[model samples]
Target: MLKDFSAQSLFMGLLTAFVGFASSFAVVLQGLRGVGATELEAASGVMALSVAMGVCAILLSLWTRQPVSIAWSTPGAALLVTAGMPQGGFAYAVGAFAVCAVLIVIAGLFKPLGRAVAAIPAPLANAMLAGVILGLCFAPFTAIASDPLLGLPIFVAWAIVAAFKRLYAVPAALAAFVLVMVLGVDLSGDPAGGVISALAPPVAFVLPQFSLAATISIALPLFVVTMASQNIPGIAVLKVNGYEPKPGPLFAVTGGFSFLSAFFGGHAVNLAAITAAMCAGADAHPDPARRYWAAVVAGAGYIVFGLLAGAVTAFVSLAPPILIEAVAGLALIGAFSGSAVAAFKAPETREAAAVTFLITASGISIGGISGAFWGLVAGAAMLMLLRLARKEA
Candidate 1:
């Protein structure tokens, strides 16, 4: 294993870790907070997710001898924002997280279940995802509306860098956010005295409490989003890069990690799509066999980042919450755009996709069920009706 190490691979692995952590962390933080987490709890959740996914990535990469990158399910976190405060507060939400994680594990073990998840119409699935993230995606603009001096610079930084390299745009926005935090925000009323003192990793053990409402509203939708948006796409990315690890074991392993992390305030973990590409690509190493080292390095990097999450959370919390959400929104823009395009691509399913998108984005609730769940139902029904009508005609 030591013989496989290379300087290029080392650099690429660390880069993968940096990009993965910096790009979408705000979304995770906000997602946790949205479901009624205290600041300390949210920070703890971030650390738990980071550490869990990091360990999972390292173990999988070493076992398979492939660049098997693991990641938190960012889309599931976005779904949390829409789900709002779960009934019975964060404990029930934690229970929902556990339930979703179990479902993921079962999906891996049961071929029929996995196939059923995979069988969802791509257009409707994509639309549901797009709708879920649509509100967050507007944060950059709305943040600017609230405070142009702080927000414009961040947007400008992201746009300028994105013009050159689309991959680095969100990080650039994050850097700009740091700059804005320094210049614009005032953090004098010290609670922990300063950010440095808050450097230790957060630790909060939440007792899980299941509820029928959370099961219907949070668990099922979260399971679907994690599968459709993150896990499947991650596997596809790996295969495209010439690695073909069995999907079942990987899914089950990640779900197990996700389940464990849930007790510590985390949401869910999955295989990485973006970071996987980074680790598996030619940039990691010219030799395909050597690229797994990048994932190992990335895993190690995530652990280190996890250790510092408390400080990052404490520091960022000083700024207006909207600013953090704005950054999160920026992080998800690519996903939103991709889903939107895919949703409307097929003329036959366009109406069904529209129904899903509209319903999900509406944030409606009925009988303790969320709009995301209802959107899927309504869209499937619309598609069925259309099919029947065509047949009759």
Candidate 2:
């Protein structure tokens, strides 16, 4: 495989890593903050997750000889932002993360549990994911309406790149967004100079403090979303592209890394849905066997990016909050589109999926549980009702 390395595979790998990391890191940061982390802790969370996922991706791809991409759970992070800080604060959230990791590992190790998780209705899961990202997907247009100068150019760049390269659309838009942020905006006026320092250190260990509230609210919901929304679809992406690995083992590896990362303030790590396609598809390499190298290279790229976590954190901090959100929103456009398509694809499940999407997007919380869990509940309820009605009729 090493001898067969080609420029196409290398470029594909680089593109995969760039798109995976650049697009959603902002949401990760926002999640840490929402869970009551300080700037340093949040940066640590980013670095830890990046390293954990990078290492897992490399190991898994090498073992399976497939483009088994790993990633920090972006949907889980979005859930965190919606869930807000648990009553037990960041420590409690960390505990919940650890719990999620354990549950994932259990699901991976126990065949029945893993099968049960995999059994979640695809339409409902996709609807839930669509609901999770809906708010962020609105960022670009919202930002443009609010700040035309800063946002319009980013949108233009996205549209132009999408029209041409297609695959590079979001990344190209991101590059343009960063450029505009640098040139069009004045950073000197801020109290802290917006210079990004490359001297990012390692993650700081945090003691986990578990609470029933957090366990139910954050842990269970996070695990469900990670498995149903991220992992299942991630596996499907590889299967659709003709690269099937044993899902249980892959889940175990990612879950083990997630468990380890929790001590260092990172959330769950799991199979990547979006970037997995980049590595698995024909675009990665003409020879399917050699495509694993693309994932290996992407893993290495993620480690390098993780090392510069401090710089990225500092740089994002310097930008306006809205702009940061806009970039994150732009990054999720493809995901949003995919989930929307999947959610409404089935005529039978359309109404149930709609219920899930509306409830999740509504962001309503009950008894400390997040809307994501409730969205699933609502969707499941509707699906069951529909089935019962159909049987009676």
Candidate 3:
């Protein structure tokens, strides 16, 4: 009776899950390629992340008795693309994941860090989060600029669909897909263009190399960025949606999952914010209790896609550049807008929030950590200093 399926709820959940999957997939694919993963290996990594997130969602939802949907570490993936994979490559990247996982597990076990993280003012946290996401949304746009002919058509097609059909849901992505096909973006270059490639089974083993230098340089920053950018926001999204699970188990599970996936070429697996929203929102499931199944469905989809990594990679490659940009931009619009509003909501902290937003959007880096991490620290310090000054007065 509890698992009794409703067509409407199931459909909504699936649509939400698919959008998340697509957006994440786009970023993961790029990150993998940047680090020189073969198409197969990259797809496998994506699949691993999907499986990890999906399983976590189902288990967490069932355990908490809430409508929880686990999602791949979106901010983590984005960071891998911007910082981890680019700077250090896959091995170093995994090292970063290990560091992040260890930190998360420790925080969950210790409780203080989790509590401290939770204690951060809602407006400040929200503002910091908005800044982080705003930075991320620019990637696809940059990707489009790098390949304009391919990007422009996709953008035009997205505009047409948005104007004519009010394609608010998955149809927007679908429209972009159709536009790519119509424009004929040269699929002949794809390695497995016509083949129905068999899915590769998940490999059970990965040998992790722990390097002190890499850990400090790559792993530590990765952990900081993942927590600051991904995990915190993810929890916030959950809280906003009225599903508040204990932070300890959630952090432990996500950390453990990231560690496992890291061995198999997965970058960093953690809680999802935007994708989880899809499952948690009114559009996905009104009942809320049934939403866990959406995560299960997404996980299943990830496994399917992972196995057919070769074919999937080929398909994604065949998609025009514009299509990718348009779809990603549209998918992120809601998240960006929501974060923007939250960022500037508090006048007392508005300057700090603005600093976070500008720094993150600047995409600057010093040593290894991203601008977002530094931005938050700077903002938080500014906020704290202002508070202390007022206390003395």
Instruction: Note the clash tally of each candidate.
Output: 0, 0, 3
Better of 1 and 3 by lDDT: 1
lDDT of 1 by residue, 1-393 (tens): 998999777766776676577667778887888888887788788899999989999999999999999888887888888888887799999999999999999888877655654455777777777776687788899999999999899899889987897756766787888899888998666623322336677788999999999998889988987876678766655665566667788899999999999998899999886677667766567789999999999999899888888665455457776776677676667657766887899999999999998998997866444566678779989999999999999
Model 3, position 389, has a per-residue lDDT of 80
The residue pairs found clashing in candidate 2 are none
What are the lDDT scores of the predictions, listed in order? 0.80, 0.79, 0.62
Candidate 3: pairs in clash? 96-219, 151-322, 199-307
- Candidate 1: minimum summed lDDT over ten consecutive residues — where? 188-197
Cα TM-score per model: 0.65, 0.72, 0.73
Model 3 alpha-carbon drift over 4 Å, by segment: 1-44, 65-103, 135-170, 191-198, 202-204, 207-221, 240-242, 280-296, 388-393
Residues 1-393 of candidate 3 have per-residue lDDT tens digits of: 366455544554555455556545767766755554555556667777777766676677667755456666555555556553434346655665677778877767778767865665655555655665564356446646767665555556556665775434434454555565657566566344433344555343445566676676556766776766667666766665556657777878888887787777776766765566555544445676665665556555655556655566556655544455455555555656766786687788888778766876776866545665677678788889888987999
Those runs of model 2 whose alpha carbons end farther than 4 Å from true positions after fitting are 1-42, 61-69, 73-100, 189-200, 203-247, 271-298, 321-339, 365-373
Rank all candidate structures by their lDDT, best first, as comma-separated numbers. Answer: 1, 2, 3
Q: Could you say which candidate leads in TM-score?
A: 3
TM-score of 2: 0.72
- Which candidate number would show the highest lDDT if scored against the true structure? 1
Model 2 residue 353 lDDT?
94
Q: How well does candidate 3 match the true structure in TM-score terms?
A: 0.73
